[model samples]
Target: MTGLSGSGKSTAGRLLAQRLGRPLFDIDVLIEQHYGERIPTIFAHHGEEYFRDLESRILERTIQQTDSAIIVTGGGIVIRSENRQLMATHGVRIYMQVDPQISLERLRAQIASEEQQGKRPELRPMLAGPDPLANLLTMQATRESWYQEAEYLCVTNGRPVEHVVQEIIDMIEPTRNENEHAASLIGTPELSEPSTSDPVIPPIIRHVHIGDGYDTIVEWGGLSHIAEHLQRLSLPPRVFLITDSNIHDFYAPMLVARLRAAQFEPHVYTIPAGEASKSQRQLNAIYDWLVDQHAERREALIALGGGVVGDLVGFAAATYLRGVPLIQIPTSLLAQVDSAIGGKTGINHAKGKNLIGAFYHPRLVLADPLVLLSLQTRSRTEGWAEIVKYGIILDAELFALLEAHAEALREFSPASKALFCQIIARCIDLKVTIIEEDEREQGRRAILNYGHTAGHALENASGYGEWLHGEAVSLGMVVAARLAQKAGLYASEDVERQNNLLTALGLPTTYHGTVSAQDILSRMQLDKKVVGKRVHWIMPERIGQVRSMTLPDELVTQVVTEFFGAEEDHSHA
Candidate 1:
């Protein structure tokens, strides 16, 4: 059944397939393991535009080849008009709806429990810097409407797994009969009201084709995988390890050891920490470092550190020698969740963060949670903000896990170490599932940007250093929730609950006094989220759903006023 992300799309789809003895098809999972690298890495490498085109083409092909199977789509699949039309033509569409609160609680529980499982990696994209629940609330607002377009609606509120499965089974019986009749009546030009009462959903399917997912992971084995994948030429063996000072102390040695173990020669280069390192000066230094290392086109560049380092090194690798193979070894939580997985690499421009970057998909991404162990608490928590985002936008169970174990999560308590890994892995799995289906983000992948619209605006307006990315995002989520409330998508109580959770986590619901609403709005205009020069916001509806909307300029301003005035805190970010 299709619905919002945490509404149990994957679980229900699997259950129905099992009970009915039909093949279960999860487009996201199908592509998860195929890529050697992460989907976000590819986006960073190939650019969103290129990724979208690739995603659309792949989706078109996949749908055409599949038979009668149970399909679980990404939350934003309905946003692409073409995909929706295809679904209506090719298969039965059903929405498995759940209460937003339930969905949110489920997500938090999923992530928190996973951390206890030891199979989890790191909690990357599921939290807001210090606050996670607020981000979830914001995410719910951003994707609610897009999820309402399903053909069949099945409420999953307070229901057991078997009960939900049976309900879907019951719906399918009538839907199938309806489909058969519709086929026979397809050519009729005129129809009576009774005959037209139930319309047949289309089933035109599309398969998104992405290059081998395996090739995306260059750092995993130096050039071993690439050597086997594309065995055209063998050049002199050399390696460039590009990272920041902080990461150099953490992961560079591990990467260097791996390369050496693989019989490849490698060298390391280090930059300072934070956003400033991603500048022309740093890029030039990297070029010089490459020259000193005798790096060549055939050699691989290993990027180790957080997002800033990855962007800097990846861009250098993309432009150096016209293009060198780049691999990613992300150290920080943020890099692992958002930056490391996607191929969009670049440093911050004076005008905006990440304004100048290349879509240079990495050869591969090797994520080792061991590297994250070295992170300071603030840095660790910074990544949690993004982790909370994954649940808010789609996965309800993950949200629940965060809520259940917020205290342990905040401190990365020893008892919760395993939970951390599972949380990270789950988020990775969720993201990979979406990226595999819509690598270019022409359709399903945009759901991943659940809180980024306002988050980016805050970052740009306040200057890159003003607030941690996750911190701004935490506040952005609050503002988005307020906007959703104003739009009447959910009750004001939902917004208050969000603010309370954030306040408890030490994350602000409003911006610091230095940032003005107009400045943020102006910077928002420069956000890449703008379509046709119109800023599209991902607003919340309830606790577990969100949808996109293009707010009027005045409305946005009013919302901003409410956001800043929503609380009386005047602390710095």
Candidate 2:
């Protein structure tokens, strides 16, 4: 079982073990007992890398040693691919998918109770922040993509623990036997489906202008439909197409071709793939390219690619000629669902991921779901991670859809295509609504960062390239669940549900690498989300809902240590 620190994974796991008459092992407590010291001390003394290695080694041994015990995992255990593989090979993995709102409430209640019991800690990230809510929002946005990929996906919406547990039992019971053969059940194939040339545009639900009943699905009818959306924008100056090589090949020509067809002179600039491309060097290169192309402030820059391309291009657009009009044409799932809609764009810095950027909203966003059809399977799967985020933050119905039809939606089939379009459209609407209400991430927007507090730090510490944005998010979501559990907002069943969903979607639910608690917490401290040196975690109160909460630095550190205790040995500093 896995979830945020205060999310109650331990309680649920123990209950499940008791019900099944099996032994239960809480990975965090086990690690602490094995080390004969607190996890926070280990992090303070040895660092995250060392802790991560030890966690992986110990986890390997534990799984090998155990028979049919109900195992409770540290939140960070799913960060590494190896740990996920181990879970796949050994026992069933369950995640507690709770809401940030509930997590905050639960933690508050637990802390109050604990205080009554005279328990105390030295560091607390939440206690240090001035605007704890704002800091919490930042964490949610950063890690939003990770928590959405859990396998079982149960929403802990402040319900009784027994009810949540019953739901999980119904989903995972051996008698039902659905999950046992889940691997063999394929949804749709990559190439067997229709290509972009075979356009399937849906009616314009939001912008219904140029074409009478024009069809536009962000991924499939992407650039081809941009001209119509631009018409709504009153034909902003010359357009600059900024993208990476991967995206340039698939849709740049089509976008530029259509732009020229519409009597606009368009220029295309390409960058390499990976987070490394989002740097000062790349930014300077883009500056030179924009200058060479005579890009003016009037001409809008269209960001086309996954999150990396979107962030880099969006930042360039933000800085170039004092902020040019930006039009977002997000091609990736992550982009379409999260980054593309919010206007939060920026590049990575050596100090951290997305360390530098701007919150420049696009004049308009064009999401073509068909584009996902051509996306690599891993990339497409990564996108699903964000789709799951929509469910975690504000749409329980969407969560049910994902749980019910993940297989069907895996490949971009016609059914899957429509589902993707519907899902993206809904997410876009939700995001736009949040942005409109809290463009600066003041209140409701903070809920969007449901699982990102630790997600970003994990990305930064792992060296972004080591894990795909979605992969990091996948593991990060579990960490958030564990943290939530620690905060006491949920039960173990919620964590289990999240884990089942993630495993079903082929996402990680544990961290098994060599990153220690202190390093992760330090990197988190460096995050833009932290205010007044405080760490705010955006946890869920239920599926489709979230809440921002301020935690004490000591509690945050302890939670981090508990999550990373599994990796205490053989890890680097």
Candidate 3:
């Protein structure tokens, strides 16, 4: 249930849940309970981003915990695409649309009644403003589309709670029967999908549009719709798909089945899953496979796994026949948010990660958050390390969202796919902006290396694949933030906030690699981004902003020593 702040959604949802014999999850109350503070206090202290983050986290949790419940969301809940998508998928979304005057009147009457009973009413943030009705009108206009997307709309302007509850109950009963019948038919695939030759994928379905015919498509059941996305790109129907052995059995077959149905020929090559497979050896093998198939330059190369597969396949697409169309279907969170978006494709050297490659953009990038549900908890949580970097470097609101939803994002499952989708879309958008400004990392793009400088060094010093990239990055961010504070370019409290946020998300904020700090510092020199014999350091000035500059060798060496010397064994992270 959602609508204006005083639209009686809370009262209606509670009574409706009781009548229906289901649990009621109120997002506003949950926030108050979790933080030990009321809505207005939370908003005033943490700002709107923090409050919205909390709102999103609470909404996601409630959606996950209950299969059958009436959820009462705050007025501003519809402002977030993730929350709206989740609600649409999980429950019968109902918008309580009523006059602002009537809603305010009802709120005031309720408050007076509570005071007469010697009880204090919970103050709403929306109502705390000087001109609440104007705020309500503005919010309603902003979220009009979101409200209209709901399955049902309820108006309780002159009605009682019982009447509203009854109307909602009548609406839900028929849908329950239809949904149960549909669930039994879930795994049954359509023998044939209507083929479209329009060669134009709608912008709505395509999540991130990077202009010039390049788009990133992200959706839950998007694998089944690959033909539709590909049709618009107008590439040769005969495509080569490269994926890791671990993922071939799961997604490759499904994708192949769909492609073949659409009259396309798809030849899949499965490589071993790990950092080792992203090498010249695998590249040679792929070249051999493509040669045997007589693959042409216009045909597309589809990458269908994590970073390892993406890097290897992307390089093959870049160098093979001088350049072929490329499509990325990144299944892992790390790849979907970081590796897959940037056109930087490469293989690791004996000494470093991504030491060899090219700046080749994929014609299309398709990411399914549903696929992430198949990943282990550790694999899923590690992706947030790179995601946190986006928030710190370019977007403070994104950072706060991460801070608020750290736990849910860490333990993501089916219930959290929509939020993850939104998160992935956000990361992709940020990377796209940077890529457009400096596709070759000439200037602003270098800020993306915020945590990656020390992060890559850790990976190199610890031995490739010894420490996951995200773990190294988690510690790298902490070290970078500390360096910023020490240089007097950042606040100590800001450093603590970054550290705390990383820690809360189950990311390691301290180094525990066995390699000596001095060795790690030396490896930092070998970074592919080095120029003028100086390493570019991306340091934070606050939660959302950062500047790129090379720090003093002594300061860098001392910080490295401090981290590498720590006794804490969060390396297990």
Candidate 4:
């Protein structure tokens, strides 16, 4: 058991062990018994480093000695990565959670009561500060990520010790039985079969091994494998699933059932289904829900819808508790190809799209193509716009592939699963390579925003919900092609090919909205991509080649004016 001091880790572990008929090994008690001194005394005599090293050694010995024992560790045990790995590897790690304020209050009350009884308990070294509650909060913030590494999280605040123990037992019993059953089947014929179905082969998972942090996985029908993936990653069993109403209506029940089967406790939070949901109000509501659920850092915030849900929930996961584990289960084609793969999380400000956000990566991205089968035609076509952007900005082969199967893709027939998966994987591969080179979008990754400058501007000017992100991007790509043509940087035939392809895919090749060119220019100026008061335009030079240029305001205005068929205004110039 792991948690802040006075959060009942020791008490719960003891009771749980008693109920399970297993030996209970409390690390703190063992350490105190072995040293013949209190923890505070040890900390005072030997530095914290010394105590931690001794604690690690004792913990290792304890684990090696008893294979079936409930081990209660020091709250700071997870602070050491090796200690976390050991606990995760050896047993079912459970986190006893409580609000910092409540835990601190409990500790203070315990100390006062003990003193009144004429038996003063040893004061915790961490709680020695003038403001113990503040110290606890600070410590919790620092170690929250580590504590979140536990597989199970149980809230102990305002709950009886027995209730908390029962929660832990309920979480662990199924896993225990499964483990025993596996042990019994070690040499049986059933054990010889593969763990997953044949269609869900492991090799189908496209792993993005980028950097020291988490990698990404893109696979067909990957949603069914979410439980196994979570177990393998050792993510906490609790999930805060964030989805839009539409996606929740379709996918929530199935996903919840699957998660339950995997012994996961999932809580669903549904927002309205549209870009309108990606706002400050919805974000605050999500934060409130997280707090109400007593969400811990180790638990996951699973974004289970399109880009709107992904962006909203991803930003919430990034900021709430200073960040928690994120799992992106992108259902829309647009998200599977682009938005979900990148770590860009945000909400639209009044002036611009994705103005308030962070670059927090998800622990996992599960893009199941099967979900796209039920997608509306408009959503599917909107997604093609991004998929086409991938082809134009990075891979000519992908461009040609889409061109060859443009009609079939539009139909989105059941027989087109392989083609859809191929397209999704290729797009993800291109994105992963770019993200690996520039994780924070400081340089090379900007190419991925091929048409986003004008695209975002259009979305903002049209009041976000007027056009799907893909639709705006589709028109934005057309504007970009025209700009490239006017600059004489790209061949006219290539621009024509782009137009033809988009038209064939039933994507927008023009925008007839009321937003004036000036309004769009103003919105573009507020874009995150603007550098030195100039918008960075991604111009396609050819099928697979693109370049970024800081075009003059007048030139961009003229191009956008032509697209909107509006009179160009030169007041700013």
Q: State the C-alpha lDDT per candidate.
A: 0.63, 0.67, 0.77, 0.79
How far residue 28's Cα lies from its native spot in candidate 1, in Å, is 54
Candidate 1 regions off by >4 Å? 1-209, 215-237, 254-258, 496-506, 565-573
Q: How accurate is candidate 2 locally (lDDT)?
A: 0.67
Q: Write the per-residue lDDT of candidate 1 for residues 1-573, one digit (tens) a residue.
A: 456555667755655564454576676555444445444455556665654455555556677776656778754456567877777777667777765565555454445434423345333233424765555456556655655665567886534343466555555454444576222212222212231232332211122124544422212112223333222224345766667655443334334444454566666666778877889988888887678667768888878778888889889988998898877767777777677775678877777777787777766665545345446556777787777777677776887787777776775532344566667666766677777777766666776776677787777766677788878788788777777777778578767756665565556665665666767777887876788999877776765667777877887889886565433436673
Query: What total of clashing residue pairs does each candidate reach?
Result: 99, 100, 0, 1
Q: Root-mean-square deviation of each candidate, in angstroms?
A: 24.3, 22.6, 21.2, 20.0
**lDDT, candidate 1, at 156:** 68
* lDDT tens digits by residue: candidate 4, 95-185: 8888887676556545644453346588898788788888888889999988888778888764544446556655654454466522221
Q: In candidate 2, what are the lDDT values of residues 1-573, reduced to their tens digit? A: 656544557655654453344677787777788888666677778887877787888888887787657777775677677877777666555667655554544444444433423466423343236854454455444444444444565665443333345455555553233544222211122222223233465544544222122222354444555676787767554887777766553455445545655777766677777788889888898898789887777888878788888888888888998888777777787887788767688878888887788877666767766565556567778776777777877888888888998777764454355666777888877776776678777778877776677878888887876567887777778877777787887568767877788777867666667777778878888766677777667787777767777876777777778766644544321
With a 3 Å backbone cut-off (N, CA, C), the pairs that clash in candidate 3 are: none
Better of 3 and 4 by lDDT: 4
